[model samples]
Target: MTAVSTEIPQRRELVTELPGPRSRELAERRSAAVAAGVGSVMPVYVARAGGGIVEDVDGNRLIDLGSGIAVTSVGSAAPRVVEGVRQQVGESTHTCFMVTPYEGYVDVCEKLAEVTPGDHAKKSALFNSGAEAVENAVKIARYATGRQAVVAVDHAYHGRTNLTMALTAKAMPYKKGFGPFASDVYRVPTSYPFRDPEGMTGEQAAQRAILAADKAIGADQIAAVIIEPIQGEGGFIVPAPGFLSALAAWCKDNGIVFIADEVQSGFCRTGAWFASDHEDVVPDLVTTAKGIAGGLPLAAVTGRAELMDAVHGGGLGGTYGGNPVACAAALGAIETMEAEDLAGRAREIETIIGDRLRELQATNPAIGDVRGRGAMMAVEVVKPGTKEPDAELTAAAAKRCHEQGVIALTCGTYGNVLRLLPPLVISDDLLREGLDVLADALSPKG
Candidate 1:
């Protein structure tokens, strides 16, 4: 999208067997050097990546449908991001925004204000990850509203930190051993149209959640109601239309801050600047990370000026919160998204994924659902004749794809959904080929 064609060929090419000799050696080294707690879905050491291809140490060219978990929407080596970061690092890498204020930090915040929904005057504070942003957002909400409780929806994935782990839904991998989490964090039901009862409308789903939240944590005690408009890491579930707006309205009337965790759904990945734009919902605060800075480690909590400014001076400063290099990368990433209108490209991706996935669904009953927006589509793999999850089948299919040099990622509370997050700049030929490979992987003889 930014005249940033990949140096590597944009195709899945298997030069050797899966986990080729070089990759196998690297895995062995990693096993020795890295902590066992860190898990990697694919162990092939990447040599370079750009556009839609990742070339590994084995020279195996893998078509990246996952986009490094949706962090490289503008391509891994987007020209703007690289150039911006290179210039910033040459000048100065880290002065620490709090110690010596720099313009890059303010520039990134300005870009956030311009892109995020709402014309209202907004301010932002930068952080290092989505979890940090969420933690800080909660802190601000509590300080501003004088409340202590935070409500999040089921199947949500806020982060891996102590506070975020409590906010997340899945427990096995994220919150299993970590106990004695932060207090006053509540979980409420959310709309999952595919799994909800028959004939339930958006308003009904909203009411059910609202009532549940009230019963669990009184509205007066609630500091914020946080949710992912398009629930990422929770099956890529797109909630029923009007469900978000209804919840936002409820938050407004109850004086609770509405927080949209747009970590994976923001920055033009969902056919809009943010998924909330699809519903025209203006969240009181938005948490963004993944795609915001291309591939840099950057995140932000942007919201109305009054709420953002409520925190005491020195209450939110961090050592590396808004590193100048990361801020520059964010600006460059934002520039590329704006100049190319990646949101429009995302819509094109949706059409491709929707048409192919739906066609496959019509023939293969195992795909119980194909739902998502733009390049963020996914299929809930289930038993052939029912809605029961088939995590075994899903994992097998992913392994088969990985074996054939196609990089795909699986997610969901049940680990049964295969999520596709190809870069918005991917060529049509590559996307089609990638889908064809996936279709083959799902077949019996593939």
Candidate 2:
């Protein structure tokens, strides 16, 4: 068992409105100094957080249903994580892993090897964000296989970096004006069952994509096919059974590396430890970040030793890739997950949230589709029977929930999907309360 030292910290109380006077003052200051491109989910400025709740500077308490965009899987301000960060900050902060190796960084990598999927000899390299991990994954795949081309799926969100933007599908916000991007990144159809051609199964969609990749990029020239098992931003679309497995098999047969961008789906966001496990498919390389360190800025690319080692010495690294604080936090987060059985909790949330949303779909025709694995669930909002997306309604519902004290987020290529990412540690009572709030927000007014 990974040892963890946890000391619960004191929780703060909220006394004012969400963006209380102080927070409003700060937001005004931020508007002038911060970049205009940067956006915030909520106007509330966070003062303190513990367990599953966040206290705003205005003294308003909120149930963190989004987990800071799925980063705080273990919980916000988890005792073990906080304590680890506290201890590590005093010892040292940054000594670039590439320049001066650190034990915490190495230890985190060792932990990643043991926990990240496959039993085969594995290696891991850390990065600062999910985008860096993905960009490096492409580098490793291309270097190892000597291929120039890469394939990604539609509605997939890899990251914001140049190479990642080329891999990402949406253009308006992410890719617009950010080109000319890295060369040889290609896109294919995604296995979106709800929107798939009438009778096509998930496997059929995968096959079609494979055929498209073969024709457009040629299997021999493709270095890797990176995808999210469950598309996070593209409406939480979970591909049908056999889709991932079939694709993995095809990649193996063609000597193409299959990379799973599990930045959002791994670490028990799904019912299983990794979303890929749901299909019994082992990817050649897995890139993860969001929840790996329970809110710390840490990410990793874990892969087969051979593929990772192919990169020459001094090829993969960053100045802040594995800051000791982040590494310590990761060790603490992993320990918290194991001891608390957070993976099992994720499954439990899926059953509860999925059932509740299914019931909502039956009554609310606006809910065109409800799909996802484990706690990463979402409902597609539409205009009754047709697929005419109701992005406006989605925004209205989200605003209603926020006003009613439950923080929720909307996603999708069309921006019509409402995603729920409550902390795995949230109590059953609190979960029910948050869901009730959501129902009220989406309920038809008489």
The TM-score leader among the candidates is 1
What value of lDDT does candidate 1 attain over all alpha carbons?
A: 0.92
Residue range 120-168, candidate 1, lDDT tens digits: 9999999999999999999999999999999999999999999999999
Model 1, TM vs. native: 0.99
Backbone clashes, each candidate: 0, 3
Residue 291, model 2, lDDT: 91
